[model samples]
Target: EWLETLPQDQLKCLVDEVGKSGKATRTVKLPTGDEEECTFLPEHVTNEKKKEKQTTTTFMPGVVEPSFGIDRILFATLEHAYYARPKDTTSEDKQTRGVLAFSPNIAPYKMTILPQDQRITRDEKYVDMMRKIRQRVSALGHSCTVDDSNATLGKRYARNDELGIPFACTVDFDSLSDNCVTLRERDTMVQIRLSVDEVSTLLHDLCWGRQKWDAVLKKYGQSSQ
Candidate 1:
């Protein structure tokens, strides 16, 4: 059926006239052991005497056969990113949760900063701290957002996991006194505490893959995984 497009019957006739037409032609061998005869058409040239009687043809410029299918591309991407775990696991104790495994370069937001006390999101100090953190990360050419939603932190993390957020920084009451925040990694759920001053550099290295999470754990004691 695939051979229907090939002009098999006409090839023999075209080959017979190749000598008389004085056309440059060749016989190509196909992968299937079949042969195809082809020839290049002669270049069009107009003589000065026949130029007046010849009619010129008009054509549209830059016309193309268009088939831009975005829905197909989106579906293929969603399938590639889908991840699921069943309810039974011991070596790696993880719950049955669906995750979209998106790379940091492709994720919508590189990191999301969450405040332990959502009620204080409007507080002057909390807003100022969040602004500074966002600004620091954004200055490094990465996108950051504050998750001050009324939902619980775990729920927020789960929702962002589906959105492919690679890292999350938690600001709690202790941060007010010690100027330190807890950073939790996605996929592994590993948490660590580090000074606020180190958040920007740590996040930049982790997101850009300049440093691994295990290196971070070795340098700073990991709270848990």
Candidate 2:
């Protein structure tokens, strides 16, 4: 019966090997309780017994749960990115500033264009330059905003920090004449001056991790606040 279970070629080889062994036919009772005459191979029976003993059953404890919602994920990301800046003792205003220090790629606005002062905010040339810079940043596929509010420069920066803007580009009287702007990083507050033409590509590289903040600082030299 065991020989019959094998392929024709394998059965033929086994029959020849058994014939050489001079093993006599023996009557064995199958699971059906009927007697069958067959050549008994002790090795085959041992291997079958080993296979039966090796079989195993596994039981799963519980079902898999559904994934979290978008709102929940956003809440967790906001919680992770949020932080509070320590109050500067030297400054006249001594209030702690809350900042959402999100990375450039994840921040809602990669860059915020800010006018240096209220007067500059009102200047047609300054406003025009700021608008052009904003357009350039947007053209490179980065989200940007223009904050031409009447608030003080410090207060405006604080508000943008709270909104999780990764970088800020300030347009001043010098920018109008020199065609250069100050780029400020959120977490470090380090500023660098670069040409308006370079702003879009530089911001794109920063957001996509092609270039880093330290590299920019090293190359451009930090600008005075």
All candidates' TM-scores?
A: 0.65, 0.69
Best by lDDT: 2
Over 1-225, each residue of candidate 2 has an lDDT whose tens digit, in order, gives 544556766555555565567554656668798888887464543222133457689998997776887899999999999999887788898788999989899887999998888899767888888888888888888899988898988899999999999999998878877899999999999899999999999999999999999999999999995
Tens digits of lDDT, candidate 1, 154-190: 7788777777788898888777778888888787778
> In model 2, where do residues sit more than 4 Å from their true spots?
1-67
Clashes of each: 0, 0
Q: Give candidates' CA RMSD values in order.
A: 18.9, 12.7
| Model 1 lDDT, full chain set | 0.75
Q: For this target, which candidate reaches the highest TM-score against the unseen true structure?
A: 2
Q: Would you list the C-alpha lDDT of every candidate in the order shown? A: 0.75, 0.85
Model 2 scores what on Cα lDDT? 0.85
